[model samples]
Target: MKYFMFLIFVLLFFDAKGQCCLHTDLSRKFDYKVIRLDHKDADGFARESKIIIELYKKSDKKLFQKIQFKTEGIGLSNVFSKCSDDRSYITGQNMKTEILDGDYGDIVIADFNFDGKEDFAIKYNIPADVGPEYCYFIQGDKGFKKDEYLSNQMLWFPWLINSKKHQLISIVSPNWGTRIYKFQYNVFSKKWRKIGNRFFRHDEGLDEELIRLKNI
Candidate 1:
């Protein structure tokens, strides 16, 4: 019985040691002031990770809002290196630039909907040739809500927002294709619309070379 108990204790100790966490202060970046990421160490990756986001009122420094979500895993080395440099898994620059450069990070902070409120995207899956998939959340009067349109259409590939044109652009890989979606308000229906999708392939300096692709 003593030996069995000792073995059990050892197992528990190793299990506890295998679990690690990374955190960052995002107060300057978004309303969610801080974020904590928890995961279990793998051979070369982290698995079963959870991201916890917290927001505080600036005036009192009191807790205002908290959100948590899960991810399958991410590259262990990448997460650790980024965390060591800044204690954050989030990249400091624009996500569009990183994606265009073929560098994918853990989180992206941006104003996704042109709502004047900041939004964010979390990398929740391993990246493919298209790029890392992200869970996009939009900020609202209540709180952040997962946006299906953005998550499905825009977050999968390297994308950018053009506030001046009210357009979102996505660049597809391998063939170097492009997709553009426009957002506009309709005076007749008294509703906002996300319409006018256009696609183009690598021009190759010739109009005939342009290939029209189906919507992704």
Candidate 2:
């Protein structure tokens, strides 16, 4: 009888749900749900993925698919948000995803360039990206804006801004050949100006050279 009771206990334990606590804020106010993996048998923990829903309140859009990515180091942490719309995805594999830490840097929505309405000024890190360590401040009005300069040999740190304006986004890809590109409607000149620093790309080895990585 004791053995039978033990079997029942094990069954109940396996049937329990794994819950992860998360607090996410979006450019538009939202409610999110986070799901993790369940161990079929008692073992340890494998990397898990989280899904954040915008809770459209009245929209019919759901995450119809997922793509997988295998990175060299820590893998893609939850740090990478749905930076763009669903159609922004550029891959065809699905894998488990998650973030070990909840800090997603500065997500302030502001008029970073002092246009008029709120733009954005998210300060995040691509510490692993090959260039110099720098925090990315991506602003958003029509699109996004990233810091022009890049640093090297980064450090492990978290950034937070005191304002409640910026809505955080991703950093410019740190791969050697990348640049922060921005398009502007110059009121004074009445012309559309595409202005920014030069791009950086990997040539052979050691020394860093400049190259264009293309626009989104």
Candidate 3:
């Protein structure tokens, strides 16, 4: 009886860690197909997940490249709130057809390097007082290569790209600061440069009355 009990416990543990659901984004606007496998607990909270992306030739749907990676899981509430209209949850024998609409899923598709090709960023962590952390994958001649600079330097804050200025603009709430990173290429050195600038809240003319004298 003890041996049987031990076996059951082991099964339960594996089940909790291995339970996964499927989400896909086959949007025609994108050149590649994206599949997201979310590994969740019994309560449906994802702790770890996998992403599979397949690049295909538009002419005949021929597979060009396949890319896969694993990253930290996203909360169920976050997924539902962001992708409720575009994603369909699937598990086991029950399969729901994925709706191909706007850019959905955990991945953010954009041209981070300003190379005219769409690159992607996947959320890997959510630090306290900061925000979500992302792993950037830039498109290359061979395939998507992980970009350490963007992944490490840029925290996933409320951000946008300024195409005219060739800059990445992000707002960090904790420090109430705005960061701008200008992207430039050097022909002689054959390297890229990211020049960053920070504008603190005080620089933006914060009201002195808002701060208490005791706190200051």
Write one digit per residue (lDDT tens) for candidate 3, span 76-132: 424322332232111111114331211224456666666677666666665555455
Note the Cα lDDT for every prediction shown: 0.50, 0.29, 0.50
Sorting all predicted structures by lDDT, with the top scorer first, yields 1, 3, 2
TM-score of candidate 1 on Cα atoms, chains taken together: 0.57
Give, for candidate 1, the lowest lDDT window spanning 10 residues. Answer: 80-89
In candidate 1, which residue ranges exceed 4 Å CA deviation?
1-46, 73-77, 84-104, 175-216
Better of 2 and 3 by lDDT: 3
What RMSD, rounded to one decimal, does every model reach? 9.7, 14.8, 12.5
Overall local distance difference test of candidate 2: 0.29
Question: What is candidate 3's TM-score against the reference?
Answer: 0.55
How many residue pairs clash in model 2? 24
Local error of candidate 3 at residue 96 (angstroms): 28
